[model samples]
Target chain A: MAYRENEAEAHDEEHHEHHIMSPKVLIGTWLGLMVLTGLTVGAIKVDFGAQANLIVAMAIAGAKAMLVCLIFMHLWFDQKYNVMIFFGSVIFVVLFISITFIDTKRNEPFRDAYDATNKPTPEGRVLVEPTVSPISTSGSDAAAQPGELKVPEHQKPKVPWPSQLPDTPRVAPTAH
Target chain B: MSEAAIDADAAHEDDDHGHHDEPFLGHHFKDHDHQFNTGKLGIWLFLGQELLFFGGLFCAYAIYRGMHPEIFVEGHHFLDVNLGAINTCVLLFSSLTAAWSVRMAQLGNKKGLMLMIALTIACAFGFLGIKYIEYSHKFHEGILWGQLFAPSPEAMEHAMHGVEANSRLHIFFSIYFVMTGLHGIHVIGGIIAYAWLLKRAAAGHFGPNYYGPVDFIALYWHLVDLVWIFLFPLLYLIH
Candidate 1:
């Protein structure tokens, strides 16, 4: 037991000395990170159009982030469990974004068609288009304008009140 | 120390062969080397998880950039490249101090360790001060995100004065703020950890034989510096 214990202590001391990252490697990572940052910033300006720009910028950013994690964070030297946890979190984020984008873009068409079929008509349940008449009285323009407002007096809109002339093709504005 | 903290003699489920009688060995570990390996491994794993957290933010930036490429290009014009580069240089200096601190600890040089750690902490504060200046400038520019808030147009006008881009540029700022802010939090955390270790180092809690904490903390601080290395370009450089 004593022998085992002494051996463990010696091993412990050796372990402590072995794991510290060398300063040379440390300097290398620093330079790498600096260059990577410069490149990513430079790339943002090139017009890879819309989609292409996003991908390229992110890929570079990911690579840079990885360098920090691997070299400075010691992820490159760490335990499997830690790597697993990190990867798991990343996966969750991906799933969330995918689900939300899909739900927004895919369900749009059916919603528009459904809204159109439910449109209201004045005469019948199934909703038919109103007929246009030669002496249309759908509004009050003829009531107020002394003969000059006429498209012919009989053709004046017949809403009864002069103030009741609703402009065609105009929808009243609604509050947001 | 409690017996719980020293586990060498308690139970051996496997064959106890070529190893025995190791003094000052923790009870929890099978051997000193194994314990050190585990500690180093643990630190790296934690770092990986942190990287992934930032990774998600990077992914968001990509998606938004793809959707609105012009906005990113225009947003680049607003970044103060000189300031970003200076801050990056400042952080690189901090990493040097951090590495020196760990080296001092390994050599059992207490005073050198404390000074280096203090320098590191100061660098972190310096980085933060630069960050504050940048954010306030943004406040002056009417530049901000559209998530649960729109930056008051008045302030944004000052920060992004003379800049021409769609309102979508605000999204770019949003990602910028979140990513940089998170990185700042890590820097703060690293400083605090270093401060605590600095005290222990002063009291001789670490030496040539027990420098794991110092090494790991330095490693963590270096990672913070590493993140800034990339941020400087992505945020400040226009071309």
Candidate 2:
């Protein structure tokens, strides 16, 4: 019992040396966090453009994140290296975003090239419901009603397109 | 054998134990403030690096988002705002308790310190529980991540409830899962840390002048909570 009591007295004597932060800062931080939380939820109702919407939401989230880090997490009281850690994270984020965007840009050229290779060759025609009319009906009554008309030129292109439209007029011409 | 010698031996044992326990202490330190400062600086450095690590993930999110804002929003619709808001509240409050625990430790209030630490752990568990609920909801909706990721009807229902919705929306869920999952993992780590600290604190290992462990842990727990603050808004609060 004496041992425990002595330990307690040691703790009490030690407590006389340090200074805790004021209650005002704590209350202010709490209030600020609640307000930001409400705003984040509120922003959902306002539909900005796709990109702007994300930007606004993220900006608010960042602010809230800062509050938690600076105030609640006590980065406010820490040494210089603590600041270094935070900034280092920010630099990494920049690198991650840059790399990802760079890759996206890189993929764009490849996508175009891929599309070029698989473009429709017009080599052959599989008979189907044509997309556009091939012949003119200047003096004939053979033309069907517009609603029920079938066009030959505008056919839905074939599967497995092998190449681009071949460089010449190879198909026989239809007299208009 | 005699009472006088037995008393002398007990005093000697205490002196030896106290000296051996303070190896990291310095001459300038009366109560281990030097060790505390070193440990605090170390934690802050670790936290700074962690911030950057998570920052990298956020940057990835930004790129994907920039490339496909519509897709991102489509996924955002799946998140439950009400639940997210509540979780934010829980985490923010947990941070408060963590702060209080450190304060109690500094005051050498063992009972108060233990209670606050326990409170913080409970808050972490609560955060985890809520996270599980959110994740299970995603699972039920068929929403997932990576190549196997899919959209839940609820997610889709929430997502395109009012937009030019399409199948491309699944990608949004993909980012959401990656970001939130990583955050969830951090919350788990903090919970384990809290438990260890709580045990030590309850055993009265800390006094007013030697509570660096509690401060560092609180700093970490706050960061964990802080990360969620950003996550909640990004994931759940977009139209």
Candidate 3:
């Protein structure tokens, strides 16, 4: 046991010098992350177009992820092979998702159906095909009323959808 | 021993004696640099797989959100922004401390490593605590996934400000639960991993030449933070 203790002490004496980041870097990274998070919250208050907002949020998120990877994860100082492995996986994921979306976007009938039902307007959405008066907010029972087709008073669409008008002439050849 | 064999052993000893006698460096490794590089490559591959694992869910989220953008805007309101932001900060702070621990281990500062590990573990628990609060609120409000989603009357009133009751709202919550739940599991994994590393650190198993565990675990912790970095804005701050 004494000999083992002596060995341990000797091991301790043989100091191994390596790279050590100053505390300033850690603090700076932490502060930067916190500020970016604050920015995310703040950006939501501004009424950018929905797509723009999504893009902005995602951009901020991507930036934060990069910081974590490069600094906190030390990918900046890590081997080139490791970086290559990481980006390769990211590329595969993006490819998989993009391919799936390309297919999903191509299907016309389903896309139109989804749009008509789930997203009735560019400004407002009508997710459910309500049978009853939307003004009646008592409960689900009020939603059971049929034939009226009353749009909810609170969620009224900003502009009437062209599809909802019977008087408008159909431009498609099939309509004639 | 045969004379030639004895000579070979002597030569091997001579070759290794002046070089790093890093205790953790395996016999098969040629040198410290070789061992570190191999371990680093393995960790990066592991991290890459982790990205793909979460990528599948992110793809699903993107596709569904594209299909029904309105549901996300409505569903996000049910999530508290302050709680999510706080959690994000907590996780970010934990990541910093985790990175610091690796640095400390690299510099042979055992005390600093132990302290940083403790701080990281504490921040992780703090994140979970906030998450629990947010989840319990959602549970009570009946904002749940799939068939179980029965938004309360109050929630319905708020969401219906300019839209009808969204039937597909359940899908949003499903994504929310799955993504965040997976992230939470990662946080727990980080906590357990850090605790183990802390024990090892206390036992003086790490130093400049052999701080592999500390470094690898820091990378894992950063990935956990990275996932949350996306989840926070996507799930909570959506307009």
Candidate 4:
């Protein structure tokens, strides 16, 4: 063990240069993340339309994630291979999401027809032709202009089952 | 440089076999640097795999949101943005402490390392505590996933003030619970890791040449924070 220790010490002397991140950088990263969080929340108030809002929110989140990775996780000072591995995973994620989205988009019409025809009414009544387009993306506009989108009556479910039914089953006599 | 010297060194190494100078150094490793580098590589690979694991859920989220924008518009109203924002800040602060703990371990500051680890654990618990509040409120309101979703009248009345409730609001809640619940589980895992780290740190197991575990765990914690960074905007601050 003594000889092994000496050998280990010799190796350490030759190849022991680890980076220790400074507290200043860590604190700064935290602050940046917090500010980005605030911006994401704040951006929701401004009317950027649905798509633009999503883009802005995602952009801010991406920035915050980058800060966490580069500073807190030390990817900036890490080996190039580690960076490659991380980005490779991110690339795969993009591929997975985008490919799945393309497929979903292709089959959207079939899904819409199925949902329109199969959706059960709150009252258990027969399905009705949807008064409004189920796949409408203008939800904010619909909300703003309330009269433009007719509020569906089925949104509110009538509860409390009637106590007496006309077709109730009668009890049978028991054998002696 | 002679064969005789090499033989004598091997004999001396065998004589000292039972008494290791650095007990923490694995016997299989040639040196601390070698062990640290190998462990670092292993951890980076694990982290990459973890990203792919989470990417599956993110894909599901994008698909769902794209299909039903109204559901997200209505469902997000029920989530407390303030609580989610607070949790985000809590995780970010924990990440900071986690990184600081690695630095402390590298500098051989045992007390500082322990303190940072404890802070990180506390912040994780605090984040979970906030999540518990949000989840319990939803549970009480019957805001659940799939067939179990039966939002109470009061909840609907409160949540759907001016907007109409989509029939597929349950899908939104389903995504919400799955994404955030998985994140919560990860936070629990981080707490457990930090607790173990704290115990080892107390025993002086980490120092300048042996802080690999500390660095690896901090890298993991930052990834957790990274996930939440996206989750906060996607789940809570939906436009």
The TM-score obtained for chain B by all candidates, in the order given, is 0.82, 0.85, 0.90, 0.92
Model 4 C-alpha lDDT per residue in residues A81-105, reported as the tens digit of each score: 7889999999999999999998887
* lDDT value, residue B117 of candidate 3: 100
Roughly what TM-score does model 3 have, to 2 decimal places?
Answer: 0.77
Worst 10-residue lDDT window, candidate 2 chain A: A124-133
What digit string (tens of lDDT, one per residue) describes model 2 on residues B1-239?
99999899878756643455665355344446546756776887788777777887777777766666666656666677788889999998888888878778878899999998989889889888988998897788777775456554565556566554644455666678778888889888998898999888878888776888888889888888877877886777665
lDDT tens digits by residue: candidate 3, B167-202: 567889999999999999998998999999999999
B176, model 3: CA deviation in Å? 0.5
Shift in Å, residue A41, candidate 1: 6.0
Order of candidate numbers by DockQ, starting with the best: 4, 3, 2, 1
Which residues of candidate 3, in runs, are more than 4 Å off?
A: A1-17, A114-176, B1-22, B158-163
Model 2's alpha-carbon lDDT is 0.69
Question: Which ranges in model 4 have alpha carbons more than 4 Å from their true place?
Answer: A1-16, A123-176, B1-19
Instruction: Please report, as a residue range, the 10-residue window in candidate 3 chain B with the lowest summed lDDT.
Output: B14-23
Kindly give the stretch of ten consecutive residues in candidate 1 chain A with the minimal lDDT sum.
Answer: A123-132
lDDT of 4 by residue, B1-239 (tens): 89999898778876854237888887668678768877888989999998999999999999999898989989898999999999998998999999999999999999999999999999999999999999999999898987688888889989897555886788888899999999999999999999999999999999998999999999899999889988998999877
Docking class of 2: acceptable
Clashing pairs in 4: A1-B16
TM-score of candidate 4's A chain against the true A chain: 0.60
Candidate closest to the true structure, highest lDDT: 4
User: Which candidate leads the pack in DockQ?
Assistant: 4
lDDT for model 1, please.
0.64
